[model samples]
Target: MRLLVAFTCLLAGCLAQKPQPCASPALMTGAFTVTTQNEKLEMYCKYEYDALGQRMRVKQQGTYQTKPFTRDYLLLFREGAMYQIFDTNRTCIKSALKDKFHPMEIPKDATLQGQVVLGSPSAPGQGLLVNTWTGDMPDKKGKYLSTVTEFGCIPINNSYQSDEYGWVVVNLYDNVNGIVDPGQLNPPDFCRDTVMKTDEEPKNFLSLFHNLP
Candidate 1:
């Protein structure tokens, strides 16, 4: 099924944070999988590294993910995970995880892995689907990068797409730092492990964090 979507690309500077490398610079290659509580969906990630053991880039693929339609690709990062998400349109998501488990952004000076962790209790703004990763590289212009650090969870700010995936009051939003050119995301990341669930069931992955049941 094809759905018509309205696009509102973020104006270049709308990015509230700096742009860091897509993946980490220490390790060379890695992979991880995140399964839903019910295990009906899975998010797969394959990381790539450069000669210096720096993660040069990464590609992602998944299904039953944000949508049960197609697959997409995302860039790996060092400060956190970076992915161009698609929902009617495309947008970027740059978020980082902290040593302490929080879901909000708080820039600090403590270096857990030789990098500052600017995390939060959750994502920057009101996001319906949020995920933080640091197995990528680091960049100075990136938003998820900072000297001060903290831990935060990705907030799944799904948009008002008529609840196509079984939502009524879906309010979609991108991480303040997530700014990408429309139609620029060659292949967006639709990994279920990184996606935010929006169901009323207590077994939903999103429910575990939203306190929903």
Candidate 2:
């Protein structure tokens, strides 16, 4: 009986410990560069790889050119050989020249949408209240705040009262820049009357990888 048990355990261990084959696809070639009237940028890029090439690194240097204005972002990538973050360090490269700039909105976590807009310094703490699509308009709803605080809440949270979503946007202050873009980060706002944002859970960095194939 003891021999049979040991044999079963050994088989399970062998099944669980099969070594994974290494992968070393070549680094991607070329940048998908584009320029618009508002902006034109180019990345001079290079590749660095692990012995397996499974781990990858991309070193990119580029200039953000808006006619007379120019700023350079030193970009690097640390993971995901197939589809990677343009800037692994998570720095705001041309934010200073961006249409919107907020030094206070940057966070310890990765910034998304116009730099994770800052909450009013006066706002007691972080919170959220659902209203119209904007979340800032006026209406009657049991308001609640969140402990999970974040950057500024905008017209969606600023100009309007909580729980007001209708044909008219009550709070014109909130510039509802909806939908977060990974490469771009923005400021966030709060307009919930009774609801405060809670630090319920942290945003996931790996979630960005979902966009990758």
Error of 2 at 50 (Å): 4.9
Number of the top-ranking candidate, with TM-score as the measure: 1
lDDT of every model, 2 decimals? 0.30, 0.25
Worst 10 residues of 2 by lDDT: 95-104
Which whole-number lDDT from 0 to 100 does residue 77 have in model 1? 28
Off by over 4 Å in 2: 1-39, 50-53, 66-213
Candidate 1 residue 57 Cα shift, in angstroms, is 4.0
Q: Which stretches of candidate 1 lie over 4 Å from their true place?
A: 1-25, 49-56, 65-213
C-alpha root-mean-square deviation, candidate 1: 21.3
Q: Per-candidate RMSD vs. true structure?
A: 21.3, 23.4
